[model samples]
Target chain A: MKEIMAIVRMKKTGATKKALVATGVAGFTAVKVIGRGKLVTDTDELEKCREKLLALGLDEVSDAGDTETLVTSFLDGSRFFPRRLFTILAHDEDVPRIIEAITTANRTDYGIGDGTIFVLPVADAVRVRTGEAGEAAIW
Target chain B: MLLIRAIVRPEKKDEVLAGLSEAGFNAATMVDVVGRGKQKGIKIGGMVYDEIPKILILVVIPDGEKEKVVKVILSTARSRNEGAFGDGKIFVSPVEEAYTISKNALGL
Candidate 1:
């Protein structure tokens, strides 16, 4: 067995769920999370801030000591964005289909925060009510 | 690399994270979950509360850091001096690879 984890944008969760179900995933776990990737700045906000500084007659805002602090503060608030994380357990052969379903559902024009998927090995599984173990428990 | 999934008491989540951070294993992902262990949940008066709240902390570390990381979680996630039932469980699993979504890099 393998555990497939996908971190996706909050808005795309509903579509992702439908796609996974269509691919024959019986069960999965999802939770709300806040995370970020390598890119930290919010360029749109930075542009607005820059325009404001320029209107105030500070053309050299990039070299201004205080404006540097202003830019950093504006970027800090956007460092982490809301996301949804889904965890699914599946047979080895089913991994590819599941990944394809998720990716197709989540891909958007704005690429950076689309999300990520990871697969990890699962040594064992157990069903509490039936006391069943291994693959039997998962299926 | 190996990923350690530790399902611990909600109250002990912070302590565990702190312990790991102090030990230099700083990055971890946490989720709020509800589960029941071998004790089969708890009963209070007329109610049988089967879904107990838990915090699942996931940390991916190099193969060599497994012992140290697990040790930190064990000590800090324990409820009392001697430990007790429902202290939670930890599972370690192999990780094939890691990637940075923004950079599209191959590995962490």
Candidate 2:
């Protein structure tokens, strides 16, 4: 079995769920979590971003007056956004389809922070009630 | 340490907990979950139930004690003799790393 985890934006969760269900992925668990990544809003980090941008030879930041506004606008994106982690345990063959559905539902024009998907192997599964083990335990 | 994920009948949570604690395997996380087993849910009279409530218990324990831990859960969580549908499932997997957040300690 394969455990598929999709970390996605809160706004896209509904659509993603619909897509997964449509693809016949039987069940999933969603947990709310906070994550930090490349996006930054702190002053020092903003300054560093400006330095990197300048080093790229943008040349437009020669005037001190324009740099402040430029920096603010550059870092105006979200610092931290609520994310939902969707975990699904499925048959190995279904992993690719499930990942595709999540990506298609959550895709956005802005490339960064769209979210991520991970697939891991499950050694075995046993049904608690019937004592069924292995493939028979999961639906 | 290996990660053990057990999905069991919600009503069996207490027994499972008791078993784990008695066996000196107390660290676990529990969550309410809904799923359908190989039976694809049950049809009671005229009603067709698609999703059933289950409890998911996650525990990370030392590798050597895997069989013992599994036995504790299996005995405590099983629903009936010879087993019945919707009993839930237990999944075993390896853990690459584990950390204690407050102390910044690694492993168990």
Candidate 3:
């Protein structure tokens, strides 16, 4: 069995979760992160991004100010790009297809509009609530 | 099932997401990533670029979804005006089996 993880970018927040669920992914975990990409070119683009984020109340500079409200709630931040981790347990043969799906979901020719895919061997997995074990049995 | 992984140009993330969403596959995960490919990150003068921000997108999909997903990704990543360079690559592998421990949902 295997486990797959992806770092995807969505136009808006929550798209990743929705897309993954639609693909019939059994279960996955997501984590919020911060990253910078090559997309930001000049002051115009940066200003536009900052303005858009501020209007959405996603821009946070102060510790307990406008952004603290969404730190955990909305996964919102002023980061160039929000980093999120998606992980799933699967069988070995399913790796390639999963990577393809993610690539399709995040590709761009211009700046940093792309996604990366990663896979790892699953030693063991268990559903804490149900006590399920093994890669196949506990995805 | 096959696991398809891609490290793409960061700007095209939305296109990738939309492509997957339109293809009836919407669920996925993302993480802030830093790495370089082919160009070995980026080049300037004689110095090597150390840190480049990228995203790692991963998915576990049925075999049938691989081709379609790849096509979508390649198309989305390719620039209409220009092409090649930082379009990135996609990696594929197999999944032995799948199941949800709590519900015992197997190989869906």
Candidate 4:
């Protein structure tokens, strides 16, 4: 079995879901995650993220209302971008098809944070209800 | 530490939790998710229900205790003596890195 984790733009999630369902991938898990790639180019968006993060008490900032410090941090370092993570487990033979479906759904005219897909080998799977394991557990 | 992900029936969540706690494994993340095994949900009459709700329990534990932890989940997550379909699944994977946010520490 293969576990595929696709981090995608929130705007494209609906289409991605439709495409995956159409490909006969029955079930998946979607998680909202905040992450960043290499840099933050948009100052406006960076300010907003800083504000939200500080408001949520995730920053080790001396002052909560320091917009200056926030701006400085945004300009100098990393920034968080909103992303949706989709986790799908499928048979090895069907992985390529599933990736194709995801790619087609999330394709963009110009790609930046279009998202990323990480595929990993699964040691085993068990169907809790039926006591099925291995390939039989993934359907 | 290895990350053990167990997808099990929602109804059996408490048992799994109790069993794990009893086994001295404390930390875990639980998420409510929808999926189905080979049965592909339940088909009643002409209705095809393709997705079934399940709980996914994620536990990052010491690698050496993988088998013991899996045993705890299995015994608690299993439906019957012989087990049945849709009982749930457990997936084990390697954890390359880990951190504790409060302590600002990393696993070496």
Query: Which candidate tops DockQ?
Result: 1
What is candidate 3's CA lDDT for residue A101?
A: 53
Where in model 1 is the C-alpha error above 4 Å? A12-29, A34-81, A88-115, A122-139, B45-47
The model with the greatest lDDT is 1
B46-103, model 4: which lDDT tens digit per residue? 9988788998876667678998999999999999889988899999887543433112
Cα displacement (Å) at residue B98, model 1 = 2.2
For model 2, the docking class works out as: incorrect
RMSD of each: 7.3, 14.6, 14.1, 12.7
Candidate 1 predicts chain B with a TM-score of: 0.94
- Each model's TM-score, in the order given? 0.61, 0.47, 0.46, 0.46
> Can you write out model 4's per-residue Cα lDDT over A8-106, one digit (the tens) per residue?
788988998999999999699998765433344677766665566556663455554575566566444333456787899888889878877777778
- Per-candidate TM-score, chain A: 0.73, 0.69, 0.57, 0.72
Q: Evaluate every candidate with DockQ and list the scores.
A: 0.23, 0.03, 0.04, 0.03
State the lDDT at A129 in candidate 3.
80
lDDT of 3 by residue, A10-111 (tens): 452266666566666787877775433222336664455445545764444455475645443332222345666577776666666665555545554332
Ranked by lDDT from best down, the candidates are: 1, 4, 2, 3
Off by over 4 Å in 4: A1-139
- The TM-score that candidate 4 achieves is 0.46
Better of 1 and 4 by lDDT: 1
State the number of backbone clashes in model 4.
Answer: 18
